[model samples]
Target: MIHSVLESVMTANGIHSINRLHRLFFKLFAWGIMGFVCAQTAYAVPVDTKSYDPASGVVVKIAGKTLVMGWDTPEGSTELTLNLSGKGALVRSITVAPGNGKPVEVLRDIDPVTILTVGQRDLKKRGGWTIFFDRTSRKPSESGPLTLKLKSAIVRSVGRRCIVELDGLEGQSFSGKLRFTLYAG
Candidate 1:
């Protein structure tokens, strides 16, 4: 009888041990799945990027209308630089409109506007470039605030066109406008 009792107790203990092990494995699997899901959620892609650098610069002219600096941008690129002739005057305003009829100002601070200069020599360096517009000011009218229009154009293989608007000082005299358009392309 004692032997039978001992046998029963051993069987019950074995069963309990097996159940505990099974529970532990289940918990570990559940935790792993949860961790994977959390990681995926934390690594979502950004809706907009702050800057981009174009690999090349393309000169675009529209018959008698205006001249456009164009290039192909990477899939996630959002920013560009405009190379302008510093001979005339420092640029006061910039416009980028993808399709909208009105123009938009990309730059706001007056300090950086004074840094742009003439000739390709100075423009080659990235320091001469400035931020004109970004995703923050993408939709001016929709935001219900008075914001500048961002206008740009994509033509064939040339990609999109970025137009820079200039405001010169009253007494300042420049030979011509040398504008450089830089962006992530």
Candidate 2:
């Protein structure tokens, strides 16, 4: 019966010692399991997600920041390479309109441009590093309306998906929704 009500509340507090009331009930059950594992790890582990595959990749939101690139993308000399393996400068952004309506500027920095490298300098502010998509997109257009800047630079192919909400830089705000694959060489 709860050990006779913990031996009548340890003999009215004088503590008659049943191993000091079982070490004060195992130190209040180890401080209630360390306060429930520090309140389940003190927040910041809620992720909220959804996915359907499509080669699985795309989540770039800058200004606050959040990038999880990987849509298995790769195409050059025409452009369409957003591999971010370079860690992408963290959104310095010469220009990026993930909304995909258009404005996908930053048509340079494909890693110091090799193949005998002939005259290449301007990397458009070097934002986030290596993010191709500019040869004027060769063709394929008709999903215009999320909004992009840099004279309406367009990049969409294979199966499009771009969602944007970027404002400011290095303060911490994010709204990203992006899927990948665009090749127009």
Candidate 3:
């Protein structure tokens, strides 16, 4: 029935080839549908669905705030938090690299390099998962994961947050990016 109707429209328009008319109809139909959908969604907010990388599972936050590595931020300053969401997902490694390729340094006798701390956060659970970095190894200048002394068993599930405390000398600022990889435990 539709083919006959198309043939009649083609005949009326002096178009003889049914194939050409069919193709033209489909093309115009597709364009009309696309235009309608675009017009409907033009005012909608764009969403990023593929932001989660394979290695990072679901990166809740990436460098939330700019942090100066070698500067002594006041006490209670916002600690860097890496929010992860996955079942049985544990941090396999965290590698740090300088943003400018220069080594992250905290010069002694010039700047105050304060204490650095990393902790496993499960608000529902108690506080048995905190690790303080050794003062000697606190000056990270290259790309490498921390040799965590604690066992890797902290699982980040729903409603949990992992926090790391970073502070260093105040003289020269050390800026860097940290990459964290996770694995199913």
Top candidate by TM-score: 2
TM-score of every candidate relative to the true structure: 0.22, 0.27, 0.22
lDDT minimum window of 10 residues, candidate 1: 44-53
Total clashing residue pairs per candidate? Answer: 34, 4, 0
- For residues 1-185, write the lDDT of model 3, one tens digit per residue: 88788778777766666677779889999999999987664432122224333232223333222211121122211212222221121232233334434333222112112333433433333443433332324444333233222111122222222222221112223323222223311
CA lDDT of each prediction against the hidden true structure = 0.38, 0.36, 0.34
Clash pairs, model 2 backbone = 64-173, 88-128, 89-128, 93-127
Off by over 4 Å in 1: 1-13, 46-54, 57-185
> Which candidate number would show the highest lDDT if scored against the true structure?
1
Mark the regions of model 2 whose C-alpha exceeds 4 Å error after superposition: 1-4, 8-17, 20-26, 31-37, 51-53, 56-185
- Off-target runs (Cα >4 Å) in candidate 3 are 25-95, 99-185
Q: For model 3, give the 10-residue run with minimal summed lDDT.
A: 64-73
